[model samples]
Target: MKIPGLSFSLKRAVGITSAKQKIARATGIPTTKQGLERKIGGAILNAVIGRKRKK
Candidate 1:
């Protein structure tokens, strides 16, 4: 899954053992399994909708 705040590929950059910690450090968003899934989904939605795009 991609981190909303980070520019690179998080899945590739982070190791399985430290994924949570790395993600938290990058985004300051702590999450459990389900919570992380939700966050990832939200990130994808935001990307699709261009939430940060300037109109």
Candidate 2:
């Protein structure tokens, strides 16, 4: 399955969310969905792309 611009495994997606949450926690950033997306969208996209290319 595909999610528009994102192409990666569910496990990988979960990892991204976990990493982002960690960053948010360390930096005192809000963990809200929109806030996370705004702060780490590029990192999440890059991670997925890099993982996909490896497989």
Per-model TM-score versus the true fold: 0.38, 0.33
Cα-lDDT of candidate 2: 0.71
Error of 1 at 19 (Å): 16
TM-score of 1: 0.38
**TM-score of predicted structure 2:** 0.33
Q: Backbone clashes per model, in order? A: 0, 0
Mind giving the per-residue lDDT tens digits that candidate 1 earns over 1-55? 8777868556656666487677878886765777678777878988899785333
- Which tens-of-lDDT digit does each residue in 1-55 have in candidate 2? 6579967678566697788678878987767878767557656776878753222
Could you tell me how far off, in angstroms, the CA of residue 2 lies in candidate 1 after the best superposition? 44
